[model samples]
Target: MTAVSDRRPAAADPAVAGQAAEEDLRSLFGQSTAVYASLAGPSHVVHTANPAFLATIGEERARTGVPIAEMMPELADQGFLALLDQVYRTGEPYTGRDVRIVLSPGPHAREAFFDFTYEPRRDAGGDVTGIRVIGVETTQVKHAQRLMTEHRALLEQIARQAPLTEVLDGMARCIENLAPQEVLVSVLLADPDGRHLRHGAAPSLPDFYNQAIDGIATGEGVGSCGTAAHRRQPVIVTDIATDPFWADFRHLAEQAGLAACWSTPILAVDGGLLGTFAMYHRTPRIPQETDLALARVFAGTAALAIECHHSEQARQAAEARARAAHDELARAVRAERELRAEAEQRAAAAAELAARMRAAAAAQAAKPHPERCQLGGSPGCTAPAEVKIADSWGDSAWGCLAHAEEAIISVRSVFIASEELGGLAAYLDR
Candidate 1:
């Protein structure tokens, strides 16, 4: 339709005008989550506020006809009151981008951010009357940016092969700090057999609590971490005191100041159980969507670190085994070479003895008897020849009984030639 046709009818119905007015009011006062408030006079007395404005400042303090400083006393010290005053006095609009403020006081306080404007509302004569505040909370967006930054740091740490404990501990602290609500993170690693859970890291947990839960068995009703590890899935125990899975661990949990735990099992790419990533709460509480999302993101990170550690361990073990086998094989080869060398030496000695015996026999033919023991060494034996020993080569020798026996043993082919007055018979008789 053309712009002229889309214009309001020349004669509009009264009911239609009232309905349009009501819709406009709804859009201004609510129907949108942006914080809106109107303050009158230099004192900045709150004239009206939208639901979003009341929610941000707290609904309990919601009221009109009161100064903004009194309703949000915390803002006075944060420089926001001065900004509003300047806008109203000078009639110059002021805008703040990513302005941070603490929403409440003391322990109940939470940090929030906003992109906001303080604009002067003027009369027909152009004199400033009041200030109109329009703001949109950027708290969630700010948190999301922080989350991505922290998550990136964690991924870098894992990629660099940092100590598993360091990576896990850093991740736990990151979640605890980033979460909108208070959270204590615990990581438990699963044994190879998937039958037990060993404490991995829990920076914020009490030492006693960590000790008590270390080495817990994985099975049904074995608390959040164990059960999650056993089942290889997420187990959300909104209240540990009442959950059957925590019956065996109730006292420890209570002492540790933990009222709730939500655990997600960390798994390998092959779907094998690696460990459990858990978030503990101080009060009985169910996890929000953001909480679960944070768990999943970090749980995957934990798995990556663990798998890398395991792979490195396996590789080192394999290298050790290979080195051992190489050493053993080298030793065997050396022993075999020594044995072969020894056998060759024995054969050479035997051949030399056979040649000597043949020469000795030829010399004996010249004189049937010798004055000294022919079998003796260069230092001839004074003892009489007592035995005649011959080898299969027909080489014979006359020697004392001791020398004869020595010849018999050293030359296996040698035997008694004949028995004389002092021959082989003497050896038998003696």
Candidate 2:
């Protein structure tokens, strides 16, 4: 009342001024799109609700003087009533930014968020009177933030050269977990020739379905993924049973419990086909804007991962070839060295043998005798030694026609004497 009374116009009573102030405050808050509600008493009974508040909590239940807990029983179990009690008891405002809440049940259940404040209202005596609820929904913003964080993690995995299956499988699982609704993810890699798609990863898809579609060719009317790869764009088949493109696979898709598929082609930077990313749904449903956005993001990531994997493979192959060539060259050098060494050894042996033979011939030639048959060993000859001879022991031997030849041939190193000049003619005459 101190500040309020000072600001009041002349002739306006305190009660009238206070009423006018309350009306002004109501007018200011009424036009706001933000959800606002006022509750009275410790039980937190709904006393007033703006259009935004009524819209947020279905209009039929927005009656005045109804307890908040009785009107929305779902909130009581979700800790909302406890938050109100804490604010009422402590007289302290409780603010929750991006608080998650699930509304309704069954297929219509929606996940939402609110940036809300529970402020304690005061009376004329400064006692806690009631609670005021003011909030702005931020579910979309929260979801966007989550999408960015998940998408960045996927890129980091790809940049670090994670295995294709691990990356793709992890990506599929992430999308399935982050998606607002249930979805199944599949990534099929294009063959090098771009004619066929091989199953790269499909953690949520049935094994039989995965095996049946492995190595599927890229062509028109070949189902959503195949057509998207062929066209190099996105293809959406809202209902597999009725879509002409899924005619061939309708029965198989039904068996796998998939009613719809939306696929986007993953293209390299040069516009070449890398692979296809697909999202499957249980009931026939069209893709939302968020769904398409998610597909585009992961599709780009898939392209990067596949291209990097291909580059790594090519590098490993080249390295293997280079190593094999190096090994072959080393082996050839070793073999050449061994051959040269063997030839050198053979040449040395031959030279030593030749030297021994030449020395023997020289010693035999240094002392000459009259011409006679030289046959000595087993092939016996009765020719005479045409000169006298002696052994190293100084034993002299002589013969006519045959005995002298036998002694020289049988004795080791025995030969004709250099000074026996008349011996040859005497032996020949005998």
Candidate 3:
């Protein structure tokens, strides 16, 4: 079996060759924090491994003549052993990109991804000797891709104006699914006054626990979420049982099987507090970088959703007021139109009455004495005739002072025609 140092071709200048060899080794494994190993023979016995490989699988197991399968038995079921077998038998290389594997077992189990290749190695005699395993870790890339997909879906829901409760609940579920470990996610919205935090979403939490903290006030030492909102920052309670902030709620939290809590305040762009995004753990555990990053990402998303919701509500309310104003204007216009129509009708009637009175006057001028009480038509007037009145409808009558007064009141423009008697007062005096 050949070591990595001996496999290189000799250079004309030994000094240059040494430097080139060192550079080649560094280049092959640089920019990667993944395990790399070389296996020799048909049995796939471990020949050598890089520092990363030894650190991952354990330094005690980093020895030659040990079969790769014996060292990392977990890879046997993950199809890595089959890939190595295929490469060794066919003299062809096999590459697996973004392949997920669960390394170790029980409490030590971790989710990992690899961009790896298994290539056949050849001896000087042209026969296949061993297989070379080169790989780069892609766990972070895998997690990021998943995170973006879920986050984009949430944004789309918000864009379409989904119910606020539905959006918040879905976001909480998304984080729960994407977390590396079991986590209970809760989103608490701030009341309009900013003094109290209201439960927005907490699917995994117990109903009793949620009710107990529904309207928790935002103040110093109020609780993890309350304190986070009050300070407008993140609050981490690694162990709820021992933390002073949890003294009031510790019994409830313990009953709910929640041991750790990390709360981050969701803030608007103007620095106003919107709500809190919290992650609860069943066991007491410190947060990793990934956990904090997840909190920040979802916290920003929550802020966007809340702002959009508030804007939509405001716009709807404004539209309703505008509609009411328009209706009022329409009513006012109709009333004005009715009043103008009534005034025009009254003016037309007055003009028609004036023309009738002029015709009556001309008719009276054509008659000599205007016999039979000029103001009487159906019944004879008991009072003597003293005034002559006529109308354009070819009707004329004579009447006394009392009858003449009645005629003027009932008819459209009938009055005394004589100017010498000084009208009705003179007739009455006489």
Choose the strongest candidate by lDDT: 1
For candidate 2, lDDT tens digit of each residue in 1-430? 4445555464356556545644555666687878888888899998777787777777666677889888777786789999999999999999998999876555856688999999997765667778988899887798888878887888888788888798889989988988888899999999999999999999999999999999999999999999999999999999998999998999999999999999999999999999999999999998888789889988988888889889988999999999999999999999999999999999998687445434443443445554544433367445664545544334443344365665655655554544423222211111
Best by TM-score: 1
lDDT of 2: 0.80
Decreasing lDDT order of the candidates: 1, 3, 2
Against the reference, the lDDT scores of all candidates come to 0.84, 0.80, 0.82
TM-score of each: 0.78, 0.71, 0.69
Off by over 4 Å in 2: 1-33, 38-72, 88-91, 120-130, 349-430
Candidate 1 stretches greater than 4 Å from native: 1-26, 330-430
Model 2 TM-score relative to the real fold: 0.71
Q: Per-residue lDDT for 285-317 in model 3, tens only?
A: 999998999999999999999999999999999
> Candidate 3, which segments miss by more than 4 Å at Cα?
1-32, 57-65, 328-430
Error of 2 at 197 (Å): 0.9
Q: Give the TM-score of candidate 3.
A: 0.69
Residue-level lDDT tens digits of model 1 in 284-376 = 998888888989999998999999999988998999999999999999999999988988998898677656654545544454766668877
Q: Order of all candidates by TM-score, from best down to worst?
A: 1, 2, 3
